[model samples]
Target: MMTYQEAMDFINHIPHIGKRNGVNRVRPLLEKLGNPQQHLRFVHVAGTNGKGSTVAMTASVLRQAGLRVGMFISPYVEDFRERIQLDGQWISKEDLAEEVSTLAPLFRQLQQEDRAVTEFEFDTAMALHYFARKKCDMVVLEVGMGGKLDATNCIDAPDVSAIASISFDHTQYLGNTLAEIAGEKAGIIKMGSRVAIYPKEPEEAMEVIRKVCRQNSIQPNLPDLSQLEILSCGGEGSVIRYKGKQLHIPLLGEHQIYNALTVCAIFEELNAGGWDFDWETIQKGIGQARFEGRQEVICREPLCLVDGAHNPDGVDSLCRTIDRFFAGKQVTVVMGMLEDKDYAYGLSQLAQRASRFIAATPQDTPRALPAGKAAEIAKSYCQRVEAVDDPAQAAFLAKSQAGAEDVVIACGSLYMIGYAKQGFLREE
Candidate 1:
């Protein structure tokens, strides 16, 4: 039996065995493991920005409806175990290690056959196998990247395939244009699956998704965003009236309102398919749903927040949230980003609102933009800019420099937000 640390090490060290061949590389290995995903029901979610929140909201609602729900997300903000969850609880270390032990021999065998699995492939397999063994009634699966080649797309037709807020993030892999990227994300829509889409997506992207749904003989359900009425929105959360029901969403930001509406649209599809979830239960679930690191307020003394807004779209949402809630305030921003992202656009947007800017490097990623380089770019937009190589130190410095009534925000990359949160908590 492998220990938890050993299990994580083994999973993390798995080399990229084959070329990027879509689901072909992972399919055979899953076949050897008894094809566990085929035995599971899924609500497959894909998009650039809001996928995580949508998955969390969907899983929470399903769990509230007395179903055993499993959730699979990617690039966890804090812990590795966060990627795989059941009934809102993370998979235990003991179960993770046990599953890794069971799969080790199969992984070795695949490697010997020139079919080695990547870390994500192994993680997806483990999640499906564990969920199957636990007899979950449903699994909310989030796509890691572009939907067509993402490891989570290996599953069969989902009960509902949802595409949330599409934007320019992975242009190198997905495509440069909105239509092209939408085409890649639309790959998750299977023949028999019901589909839901965020109502406010760009027309170009919507056209591509509409074309795909047309080809599949499916009409995608979209949330009526115009029907959404914001009763109250503050740093705590938002109160919105949707579908003739006033509900409280615990996640912050107006963008989260959009995500909650998308979840509502998804559940409408599920209810139509005979899930039988009432609006009360759905409202309870939405109010109970909480995901960390997205406009998360870690401290209130100096008003420190940490957000994983690495791309232009995410930054735009964050900026709007700030402008709405903390208007006419002195704001200091600690930002970090990956080199592969549109860091310049994100930094420029953040700089417009930041009284001071501290650039930091994201941890544990080879593609992290250098802190000095980010600061140089930020200086073009903000008058006060400093480069700090350590994310935690940058967070601490930002908080310390802000007045008691001022605001300090750590944003940009999820890879660095965890460390920034640690610093903020320590300050608190």
Candidate 2:
């Protein structure tokens, strides 16, 4: 049997379980394990974006409600341990190792029995087992990809299903249209489950969500847009209306108001179901919750801003926030992206807000845009664009060129932000 570290190292070698769609692999594994997932309650979250932040907020609120909550989030910013949390803290390394070792034999036996589970399937099962062992009152599970056939969707109906914001992403696996993407996200909505959706004012995405809810006989609670008022939106942060109270979220970006509203709506649904929570607790949770790599500010000396804006709309939002707060400030932008993403669209959006652009590619799976190629795309929007394959070196160069008052914005992929934090911010 492999040690936990050894098992994690081994799993890393198995390419991510993304390209393949469907719960075919996880279903049988759950059956073999007696479906530990069934014993646990879930708050399943799925959407094109904001789902992670929404999960964070929901878990915080649930914790505030005095429930033992287990959160399983993916695409870790720093450590694999960050992906799993209990009572709002990262699962201890010793416990993480113990859990992995305890489950290793079962996973191996299943493989020997000719059940070749993907890495995600194994991780999903591990999360279920860990949550069940801890007897968590509820598990906040974020879908790895689309909702319908995602490995995380194998569990029984969640207590509440929440869809953050829907948009066009993963076009190859999901359809290429907003409606098609919305349908994939909407798959998590079970019959009779009360759903809280971020007010997707956009016509196309909302239409698909409405159609799915109507078909499944699910009651969709669309956010009352009229009630959500952005009191302050900029570097200082955003203030919004929630459950008839004005709340301020520490996270930057106006789009975060949508994330906050989603959390408020979910909490409202849970409250109506007999969970008692005061607005003060909700405010504390919102203010304290952190979502790394999305408009994350790491250094004030250089005024560096790191964000994981990999798509058109994401970059647009980042650019809008940058303009709103850092307007008239000469900004040095460090950028990188996966090759499959709309690199041209993202680059164009940031190019307009940047004084200088440094493009790089971190260690990522298939489709990491080569720095040279990313720079080529960036050049269409700016003349001061440079390509460096090493993300750390790129951040250093951007900072070296930046003036005292100039802002350094790392806009592209989360990998870039992770690299920047690990490599450059550590010394600072």
Candidate 3:
């Protein structure tokens, strides 16, 4: 038996295995491991953006319905434990450590027998094992990258599959256009599975989803929010009238309405499929469900908000949210992004929303755009673009310039959100 420290060391060493993009790498090992992923009912969500929020919303609704829910999300906002949550709480460190210790040997054997597993595959396996051992009633699993080859797709099938506003993202792995990306996302739509979809823009994305649904004999239902009586509050979340009752979600942004409606659609589908859940519980779950790094409030002194908006769609949503909530306010933005992303487009979106900008590089990632380069790119639109190599320093400058009424938004990548939350949001 390996000690916890030894397990950590072993798993940490596995990080050097580099990125291998394909499903073939994970399937055999998952099969050998008794396919732990098959043990739990799943609500699988895949998309370019809003996947995390959709998962959170669905899990919240399920939990409210009184089911023991397990949630697995990617690109941890704060801690690795955040990736696996039972009900609404983060998994205890001791439990995770013990599970990691027990799984370490299997991880090593898989690496020795086949090729090494990517960090994502290793974590996805861990989440499945953990959720199964915990005997969760349902698990909300978020696809890490593109759906087809994403490690989380190891699950044979899910009770409900959802695509949350697919757009042009992960071009290298998924495809170059919206249709290609939508096709990759549509891979989550299993044959005979019930699906909930937010209304896809560009029309072509919806066509891809519809074609996939027809081919698989899957029922894809696009949520109709016209029936949802929406109440938009300034700077807070939104309240909706669903099934003749009021429900509140502590998340802002109109894009959230689509995610919220997707949750309702999933619940309705599940209910019709013989799963029982009440509307009150669904509302409670939506109100209680929380995920950090998406429009998270870090400081009130100067009203700073940090969101992980890495893609153009996400950036546009963030900008719209800012415009609606903080219009006419002086906004200073702290930004950092991965090199391979559509950094230029994402930067343009953020620059158009922010009055000033500070750029920084996150720790130990080859894909990170250097602070100087990011600042130079941002300078094309904003008059004041400062390059700071350290995230803490960038936050400091953003906060320093922000007045009492001004708003500070730190955004770009999940990597940046992790550091920003730790450096700025970790309140005493």
Ranked by lDDT from best down, the candidates are: 1, 3, 2
The model with the greater lDDT, 1 or 2, is 1
lDDT of 2 by residue, 346-406 (tens): 8888876777888888665566888888888888888799888878777877776678888
Q: What is the C-alpha lDDT of each candidate?
A: 0.91, 0.80, 0.81
On lDDT, the leading prediction is 1
What is the lDDT, from 0 to 100, of the residue 251 in candidate 1? 89
Candidate 3: list runs displaced more than 4 Å.
1-5, 15-22, 242-244, 425-428
Candidate 1 residue-wise lDDT, 319-402, digit = tens: 998898888999999999999888989999998898999999999889899999999999999999999999998898888777
The weakest ten consecutive residues by lDDT in model 3 span 15-24
State, as a TM-score between 0 and 1, how close model 3 is to the true structure: 0.94
The digit string of per-residue lDDT tens for model 3 on 179-259 reads: 898888888888867999886456888989999999988777787656777776557788777657787878767788778
Roughly what TM-score does model 2 have, to 2 decimal places?
0.94
- With candidate 2 superimposed using the best TM-score fit, by how many Å does residue 172's alpha carbon deviate from the native? 0.7
